[model samples]
Target: MRVGVDIEDGGLARITLRRADAGNAIDLAMARGLLDAARACAHGSVRAVLLTGEGRSFCVGGDLREFGALSGAALERHLMAVTDALHDALRTFAGIDAPLVAAVQGAVAGAGIGLAAAADVTLAADDASFTAAYTGVGYSPDAGVSWSLPRLIGPKRALDLLLTNRRVPAGEAAAIGLVTRVTSPDRLAAEARRTAESLRRGPTAAFGATRRLVAAGLSADLGPHLDSEARALAGLAVSDVGREGVAAFLGKRDPDFTGGAHRL
Candidate 1:
């Protein structure tokens, strides 16, 4: 399988891209594997998810070499199949309750950029670099790049990267809000694990609500957004998890939200 999934104790799920030989390139099989992994995470009781690559580079994008062999109708069919699977995976990852943390290293290009951008929190290794390779390859954006990029770094900056296809280094990427944190290469794995662990012990449903609210805010008008926020807040306030959190706050204790304890 081109994707590996490991669900650890305490509801932390780790998903790794496993095509190290090709910089974890997304082939049809990889896309299918990704979709399966994503579906597993969403369907399970995972509290947090960690996404990373298994080799030197995070992901170099699609398997263009595979594409190079096809032409005309064959190429069209192959492309559609790959995108169908990839889009399903992306959609599942974005809609799930578990917060996503991506630990990226080496090169992140094309669809890889979209994957990183979709993360709730992205951490980059010191040596990490990002590029938008679509235009250079005589293609347009896919893998949710067009939808996530502009929301991430603003439309103008997103356009500049898309049009120029320039490489953005780790530090610059963090400064531009492309990544949440940048750590030394030696410490990247440990830091990412620690971050996911911390989130695993948090209120999973609350984390999901915050993420969804932010997504909703992008397209919602002020009045409607306020109404939506009010409704969400009210819903959470009465939830079992919310009551436990309130009690914990009053008693100066840690809140526990495990095993559907948060439901009522």
Candidate 2:
């Protein structure tokens, strides 16, 4: 399998890119594998997901070699198929209630940047670097990179990266809002796992609501957004997880969100 998926007992799903030899580049098979993995997480009892790459680079981008093998309409069709699966995977991950965490290292470019930015929490190794390599290869963005980049780093910065394909080091990437934080390379895996585990123990339904709220707030007017928030909070307040959370808070103890009847 080009993608390795493991769901732990506490509902933490770990998705690893297994093509270490190719810098985890997204070939057609890997793209399909990713979609399968994302669907598994979405359909299972997963409460959180951690995405990581197995080797020196998180991902360099798509497999140009594979693309280079084709031409004319064949290339177009092949790329469409690859992006279709990859985009579906991204959508599936976003639609899931489970929060997604990504730990990126080494080179991150093109679709790799898209995958990292799509995560709710992106942790980058200090040595990691990011670049928008699409233009360099005479290709446009895919895997939602164009949409995510502007939202993440603003229009000017996003355009600059996309047009120039200049490399942004980890520190600069973090400062520019490309990643949530930066950690030492050695600590990337541990920190990502710890973060995912922490999220796994929280109220997943509330997390999902909050995620949707934030996404909606990006385009929603204040009055309607407030109404949405009110409705969401009111509904969650009566839920089993919410009740447990309140009771635990009043009792001065940690809440066991996983033990709730809803288990959401």
Candidate 3:
């Protein structure tokens, strides 16, 4: 049960799930730490986040040891509490003001894959393999994968992986849009950082607004979508970050964003 976070180059902050000896499996402690780290990142001055695991395996889903010995209502309560705890972490990532990039390698199964999808972008190692391991172990999907994955790759492709519990390799995962990029095992982190930094250096207000609008646009009607987009763009134009960005473009200079001028 280790929690470590650091500021990386180009405003990309990293929160590592640090149980290397246990493959960084999502236990109650790890889940709580993850949620806490994400919250801290949100309130701090960082522009982007990088989520990664410290071991060979990215994550192996819920820790069975946390659930294997429970019984009766105790088991039910334990499962429900832990599940919601994870969902809260997922929600933090889902609603973050800045973009998140996940670096995945080895096994990304069950809730681990859910965490990957919750990220704004993902970079995976070619040797990476993901699965809906829930069914294999007499469980089902948790951590909001059912909702998040479909938003990413669509229902048809998402259902195929969820229903079949099939292994989605890194290359095929990228082809199906599960992963944004695939690289050698050693390069996944660098690739994730590259993308995170790009987002960090862009118009921070525009990125935050776009993320908010697109999320609402998914279920909104056309009129509402336009209304939301218009408001978002209008808001961006007056924002401190936005104004600096526009000024920089016109002045042929780089924009220097100090972060935290507006509330998300």
Candidate 4:
């Protein structure tokens, strides 16, 4: 399989890009596999997701060699199909209650940047480098790179990267808001897993609500956003997780959201 999906204990779903030889590039099959993995994670039981790529690099980008094999309308159609699957997978991940954590290493360019940015928490290895390689190949952005980049690091910076295809090292990428944190390459996987596991033990619905609120707040008016926040908080406050959280706080204990009979 080009993508590996494993649901470990505590509802932490691990989605791995398995094309190490190709720098985990997104070919058509891998795109479809990612969609399948996303659909699996969308199941109600999943609490968190961790995305990683095997080998030295996280992902270089789309499989350009595959694209280069075709021309004319055929190439256009092929790319559309690839993006269709990839975009749908990203949308599915976004719509899920489970928060996503990405552990990126080595080269993170083009669609790889989009995938990293899409994560709720992106942990990049010290060796990781980011570039917007679309324009260099005479292609426009796909996999939501155009939408995510401007929102992530602002339009001017986004344009500079997209236009120049200049590589941004891990430190600069984090400083520019392209990644959440940077760690040593050796510790990247462990840190990501730890982060995902911590999230898995929290209130899934509340996380989902917050994710949606943040996404909406980007384009929403302040008044309407406040109203949305109010409604969301009210709804969650009455939920079982909320009750457990309150009880735990008062009892000086940690809350258990895993549907156990133990005290909060």
lDDT (Cα atoms) of all candidates against the true structure: 0.91, 0.93, 0.81, 0.92
Report the error of model 1 at residue 129, Å. 0.4
RMSD of each: 1.2, 1.2, 1.8, 2.4
Model 4 per-residue lDDT tens digits across residues 53-136: 999999999999999999999999999999999999999999998999999999998899989999999999999999889999
Q: Which ten residues in a row have the lowest lDDT in candidate 3?
A: 255-264
Q: What is the lDDT of candidate 3?
A: 0.81
lDDT of 1 by residue, 15-51 (tens): 9999999999999999999999999898547889999
Worst 10 residues of 2 by lDDT: 255-264
Q: Estimate each model's TM-score.
A: 0.97, 0.97, 0.93, 0.97
Instruction: Assess the local accuracy of residue 89 in candidate 2 as a C-alpha lDDT between 0 and 100.
Output: 98
lDDT of 3 by residue, 121-191 (tens): 88899989999788787887898888878988899988888888989899998998888889999778888
Q: Candidate 4 clashing pairs?
A: none
lDDT of 2 by residue, 95-152 (tens): 8888999999999998999999999999999999999999998999998999999999
lDDT, residue 26, model 3: 80
Clashing pairs in model 3? Answer: none
